[model samples]
Target: MHSASIVEAYTVTIWEMLAVFVAGISAGTINTIVGSGTLITFPVLLATGLPPVTATVSNALGLVSGSISGAIGYRAELAGQRRRVLRLSLIAAVGGITGAVLLLTLPPTAFETIVPVLVALALVLVVLQPRIARAVQRRRERTGSPAHPDGGPLLLVGLLLASVYGGYFTAAQGIVYIALMGMLINDTLQRLNAVKNVLAAVVNSIAALFFVFVAELDWTAVVLIAVGSAIGGQIGATYGRRLSPSVLRILIVVVGTFAIAQLLFRRFG
Candidate 1:
């Protein structure tokens, strides 16, 4: 009887791990393309029976690898943007640390009411992404003057605020980053996107280090996500641009809908 139980336990664990891996792939890809991958992985982790807090921490930490992979895959687009990315990275790191501290210290009760709303908001952002992008494009065309290459204080302040939010809820942060970039700086969207990936990765990387040391972690889940995210990030960075805008919009809607459902039906679902 003992042997049978052990075998069964191992089998179950393997299946759970596989599910996490698949979730990570989807998350990494979606995140690279539209910036709300957490809506995919976070819900999966919760459904796999992890407590909300544990799953959030693990998801945050595990996705760091994916961020790095995605950023690296965008290296071609990152040329000439080194100084800009570096300047913003320190601010993101500090904000990320602050957010991690809050997560560690605050009680679960604090987030219970707010998390669903935040996730819902992220879904809405994903849905409106194309409209938002087009609006920025039109605004730039109307201005006829290139926005500052090095944005002034407004850009710095915006990045700081975005990083703090990322450290907290951490969904759709890329959308905020890109919006700020598109409006405040003169740059191609592709290059701005590459910068967004690296800066967000820095914030997450700093927060993940803290979580690894300070929190109760599930290493098994972390490793599975990391591996899957690495693969997914590369696929997204390479082929994601080739996908039609309509296809991307459909994917975001599907994932975002699932996220809303999961959050609404938390206990029973």
Candidate 2:
């Protein structure tokens, strides 16, 4: 009886690990393409029975590899942007540290109450991204003046706030980054996207490092997601652009809705 129980436990653990790995792949792919990959992985982590805070921390850490991969893939677009990247990265790092501190300092109950609301907000952002992009484009075309290459103070402030949010929850941050940079700076969407990836890497890496010392972790889950996301990052850079945006958005919404339902049930059921 003891032996059978041990075998069953190991089998279940393996299955759970596999699920996390697959979720990591999906998250990494989409994160590279457009961001918000946390929507895929965080919910899966919760389903695997991790607490909200732990899942968020682990997700941030795991996706670091993916963010780096995505940035590397966009190296061509990143050329001549070294000074810009460095400047923005400093602000992002500060914001990331602040957000990580907030996450750790807040009570677990507070995080629990806040996360569902955050997820809901992220879903709304995801849904409206297209319209937002169109508006940004229109504004860009109307402006006859040259855009500030540095994006000025307004962009610095915006990026700082966004990085704080990314450090805390990490969903849809890329959309926010792109929107801010698009309006503030004169650059093609592709180049802005490359910068977004780099900023994400900075924020996530800082937050992950903080979590390494302060947060409780599921190492197995973290490792699984890290490896899977790394692979998915390359795939996303190479082929994710070819994938339909509508399909990806739909998938994110579906999974996010399901996750919300599960969370509400868990909290109130």
Number of the top candidate by TM-score?
1
lDDT of 1 by residue, 159-209 (tens): 887787678657767766766666567666677778888987998899889
Model 1 residue 159 lDDT? 81
Candidate 1 clashing pairs, residues 3+ apart or interchain? none
TM-score of structure candidate 1: 0.80
For each candidate, what TM-score against the reference? 0.80, 0.79
* Number of the top lDDT candidate: 2
After the best TM-score superposition of candidate 2, give how far the Cα of residue 201 lies from its true spot, in angstroms.
Answer: 0.5
Candidate-wise lDDT, in order: 0.75, 0.80
Q: Which stretches of candidate 1 lie above 4 Å from their native place?
A: 1-4, 109-146, 243-269
True-structure Cα RMSD, model 2:
4.3
